[model samples]
Target: MTEEELRQRVAVAKKFMSALPFCHALDMRIDEAGISEAVMSMPYDPQIVGDPETGVVHGGAVSALMDTCCGFAVNLHPECVSPTATIDLRMDYMRSAKPGERIFAKAHVYKATSTVAFVRAIAYEDDPENPVATATGAFVFSKSRKAGKGKAADKSGAAA
Candidate 1:
């Protein structure tokens, strides 16, 4: 895509996602942009507690951020559509992300086909050298056999 087009598309995606009910509440924001990569960040939220004693962010929330980050990375290709689902999502939690800490993640699209895409990313708490978790996922592109934007997939093996 042209530089201007890229800017416009990024702007559009940012506005679309930023306005999302869940995304807005979590402080999620698109952080970086490129042809095959994207970065996103979210601050700690009281609503995302998985364990009260540890003040850890819920694993589900982490997966949500990772999924969207990867999806945006794939969509950066300029030929992509919004209707996609995570075929598989594997998250490796090296360390629990603390509730007050910020999570910054960068996602890369390793490869893509008409039906499938491979992606990976690292998420850390303000420190790239010490990532809190890593993710690898397979996502499928879906289009209108009928009209719909498609649904986000479950982080587990369950279907979307």
Candidate 2:
């Protein structure tokens, strides 16, 4: 895709997450996006501590980054603004994220069809190859339609 098209995709992803409560609270930021790839970043926060004993980043936080990137990647599809649902999110932990560190997530669309969208991504600190975790997800496009150019996804495509 052209740079202009990628910019528009990134803008759409940002707009889509602007209203997400957790996105705001976590301070998640969209680094960039192309036709099938998206990059997102989130810093370690005290609020997202995984364990009281170790005070390391929680696995859920890593999952959240993956989910955000995957969802954003799906927006690249030319299906209009259809509501999408995360039917499944599977994550594999390869390491741990130290506190005060930042996690960078990169997601790519493996395949997308009318009923199901598939995505895979990896999360790591500073380096992209040294994965802290990896995730795969399947999303069901909003079955119903919704109003507005950017809005919450509907359960069905029938417009809410």
Candidate 3:
């Protein structure tokens, strides 16, 4: 991707993050974004702790992060012409996240058809190899929107 295209994708990712109330509540931020991939981070917070004694963040919070990251990956895919919604997501928890550590989710679009995109993501605290959870998901995009000359079109059918 060209520098301009990368900038555009990052802009769109930031806009998407800003518009989500849950993202704001979780303090999620984009770390990097590219053609068909994205990385997002969420700081550990007491409010989202699933176990008070252990201070582990809730599974639901991690789910949201993975889902949102997957959506971003789909939205930035070259063939995707519009915004996407999660059709299905399957997550496998390997272990509880370490307390007081920020969590990061990295997602990539592995395949895209006319209607659906397949994604794989991993959520980890410090090392990508040792993931706290792994997820696979399918996202659906609009058939009505058409891809623009050099960029994926938005839901309004305009180049993003």
Candidate 4:
């Protein structure tokens, strides 16, 4: 992709992440975005600890991060011109994230058809090789609604 296109995709991904209420509350940010992949991160917060004794981050938060990263990848895939909704997602937790560590999620859209997209994601603290969790998911392209002038159109064909 051209530099301008990459910048545009990155902006779109960041805007999407910022708009989500849950993502906003978690203070998620997009570190990088390309035509088929994205990287996002969320800072560790004591309020989101699942195990007070170990200070482990909550599983729910990690899942959300993975899901959002995967979704962003699908949205930014070059072949995808419409919005998509997650049809199914399966996540595997390899281990708990260390306390006081920022969590990073990287996702890639491996395949995309006219109707569906396949994505894989991994969550890590400091190293990508040792992932805390991994996920694979499918998203369906929403053909029912179209986009006009780079803006999403509602069911009634109005800008959303």
Candidate 5:
């Protein structure tokens, strides 16, 4: 994709992030976005600490970040035009996030059909080799009938 097109897609992801109340509460930010992948960052906050003694980030927060990151990647997929809803998402918390460290989730959409998209993501604080969490999910295009430019059609050329 052209630089300008990528810029626009990133802008859209940012706008979408800003509109999510939960994301805003966690200070989620889009670090990068392209046609098939996205990276999102969230800074450590005392308000979200689940363990007072350890100051570890909550599992819920990490899961949300992964989910949002994966969704953003799916949103920018070349074949996925309309909004999508998560059909299934499974997140495994590999480790706890360190205190006062920013967490980032990088996600990529690996496959896309007319109606569904598959995505995977890893959440890490500093080293990508040791991830805090990993996620795999599938999102389906909105079943709404509203047609648009990038809408995928069925074999019969009808909107799916």
Candidate 6:
């Protein structure tokens, strides 16, 4: 992608992320974004602790992070000209995240068709090789999002 295109995609991703209320509540931040990949981070917060005794972050928070990261990856894909939503997401927990450590999720779009995008993601506190969880997901593009424009297009290519 050209530098201008990359900048545009990044700006779009950041704007989308900022608009999500849940993202703001979770304190999620964009670390990096590329053509078909995205890295996001969330700080460990006591409010989201699953185990009070251990102070481990909740699985739901991690799941949200992975899902959002996957969607972000799809939005950055060259073939994905429209907004996207998660169709399916499967997460496998490997271990608990360390207390007080910021969690990170890195997601990549492995495949993109006309309707759907396939993504893989890993969540970790420090070492990605030793992930806290791994996720594989599919995202579907919005039918209302028109090609090369912001308005919805009909099957006959007219604006809806």
Q: Candidate 2: lDDT over CA atoms?
A: 0.80
lDDT of 1 at 36: 69
Between which residue pairs do clashes occur in model 3?
none
lDDT of 3 by residue, 29-97 (tens): 999888889999999999999989899999999999999999988887866667899999999999999
**Each candidate's lDDT (Cα)?**
0.80, 0.80, 0.88, 0.85, 0.85, 0.89
Poorly placed runs, candidate 5 (over 4 Å): 142-154, 157-160
lDDT of 6 by residue, 28-62 (tens): 99999998999999998999999999999999999
Runs off by more than 4 Å, candidate 3 = 142-160
* Best by the lDDT measure: 6
Q: How does candidate 2 fare on TM-score?
A: 0.81
Model 3 vs. true fold: TM: 0.86
For each candidate in turn, the TM-score is 0.81, 0.81, 0.86, 0.85, 0.86, 0.88
Error of 2 at 85 (Å): 1.2
- Candidate 4 C-alpha lDDT tens digits along 1-160: 6778778867876876688999999989988788889999999999999999999999999999988889898878765667678899899999999999999999999987657899999999989999999999999864323323343333346633
lDDT of 6 at 130: 96
* Pairs in clash, predicted candidate 6: none
Better of 2 and 5 by lDDT: 5
TM-score, model 1 to reference: 0.81
**Residue-wise C-alpha lDDT for candidate 5, range 56-147, written one tens digit per residue:** 98898998999899999988876556777789999998888989999999999998766788999999998878999999999985432334
Q: CA lDDT of 137 in candidate 3?
A: 98
Point out the higher-scoring one by TM-score: 2 or 6: 6
lDDT for each residue of candidate 1 in 1-160, tens digit (9 for 90 to 100): 7899899878877777777787777778888989868999998888888998888999889988888888778777565666567889899999889679888888998887656878999998888789988999888864322322233233223543
